[model samples]
Target: MRARILSVKVGHVTGLREQKKQATRAALGAAALRLAWERGPENVRVDDIAEAAGVSTRTYNNYFSSREQAIVAAVIADRESRVAAAVVGRDADVGLGEAVIDAVAGQYEDEGGRDALLMITGSPALRACYIDTVAAIEDPLAEAIVERCPGVDTLTAQVLSAGVGAAVKVALRQWLRPTSMPGFVMVSGSVTDLLRTALTPLRPALEAAGDTEVSRCRL
Candidate 1:
């Protein structure tokens, strides 16, 4: 009974610690985004972001490597994980390319994502940061890809995931550019359409993965 009680107490403590960390991370990301929106990414400093987040400068560094990461965190918070979940939850019959494109587009279908997309499109610094941050989704995506392509090597899964990430970045750039309008205005076409078009090149690879999965199942 005592050991069980002790285990429960330890679990509670760990959960609380995680909650605190998540709260601090969210606060920092929100502050960074707000500051960057109002004053531009170039003008925002780590101290300023920390103060805005109601945390110490050291705490800010503990969470993010740079101001760019902190600022972009607001835009990307929980999104990569969500994408991986979406990809994994998709029907087994669904093509991997279609699943990935749909999952990626699904992230931007909301009104809430509009402002962040606008800000990223408008600011050169933020755009660069956004492009780089897309790569962070690769690890989670690789996990999902591995699940679908169990017969393939880990390196193959990683490469396919990285390729998907690159396609997303390219599609976003293509969609955001040539708009001939300000950031506040809506860009043409659905993000889904852009992602589908950009990711079309990966259909062959995804088909191969599906074939591999089918072969493994047969075996």
Candidate 2:
């Protein structure tokens, strides 16, 4: 009983710590975005964001690597996990490919509107950071694929998720391509459409994995 109680107390403490960290991260991201929007990304320094968030510069460093990353985080906060959750939460009847593509496109469909999109695209540094964020989807997405397809091996799931990440990166890159004009980028097409087109090639692989027999494969 004492061991169980101690374990429970420890878990509670750990949960509280995680919550506090998330709150701090959110605060910092919000401050970074607000500052960037108001003063431009180039003018918003790490010190400025930290001071706005009421945390030390050291604390800000612990959460984010750059002002651009923090600003992007505010625009797409917890999006990676939400993508995975959406994939997992889909009805069993839905094809794995459709579910994944829909989840990704839907989550990103309304991210921050025209102002935020323009701000991110106008700066090369911010555009690079934004593109890099797509990689974060792999781990959670791998888990979701495995859950949705019990026969899928860890390695296979990881590979598929990596493919998905790659596709998303391509889509984002195309959508945010730079124009001939300096510091100007054209929004070429709808991001959702680009994502769908990019991901469509992977549908067969996803469906095959989903249809894999448990007897023929090891999870």
Candidate 3:
């Protein structure tokens, strides 16, 4: 009884710690975005964001490596987990490729709005960070893939998720192309369409993995 009670206490403490960390991270990201929006991305410093979030600069560093990442995090808050959850929540009859593409496109289509998108595209550093954020979907998406397709191996799921990330980056680059004007980007066409097109080529691999049979699984 004592061991069980101790385990419960430990779990509660861990959950509380995680909640506090998440709150701090959200506060920092919000402060970063507000400061960047009010005083251009170039003018917003790490110290400024930390001060606004009521945390020490050292605490900010513990959460994000750069001001741009923190700012981007505000726009992309929980997107990775949401995308994974959407994919996992799809019907069992849905193909893995279709589910993944739909979930990614759906989440990204509603990400922030014109103002936030323009803010990210206006600054080269922020644009790079935004593109890099697509990679964050890999681990969670891989787990979702494994859950949705029982016969799939971890390595296969990981490769598929990485491929999806690469496709997303390509689509984002095409959508956020630079123009002749300095410090300005020309966003072209529909991002959802671009994402679907970029991800289409990976459908075969994804479907194959999803259809893998336990008897045919490699050692």
Best-fitting candidate, scored by lDDT: 3
Per-residue lDDT of candidate 1, residues 85-174 (tens digit): 888788867877677777877875652377777777677666677777778789998887777656666787799888988898888777
Relative to the true structure, candidate 1 reaches a TM of 0.79
Model 1: C-alpha RMSD to truth?
4.1
lDDT of 3: 0.90
What overall lDDT goes with each candidate model?
A: 0.79, 0.90, 0.90
Q: Ranking by lDDT, best first?
A: 3, 2, 1
Q: What lDDT tens digits, residue by residue, belong to model 3 across residues 55-128?
A: 99999999999999999999998999999999889886787778988999999885877799988888999999
Candidate 2 per-residue lDDT over residues 155-206, each given as its tens digit: 9999999999999999999999989999898898789999999999999998
Could you tell me the TM-score of candidate 3? Answer: 0.94
Off by over 4 Å in 1: 1-19, 37-43, 110-112, 178-189, 213-219
Model 3 weakest lDDT span, ten residues long? 210-219
Model 2 score (lDDT): 0.90
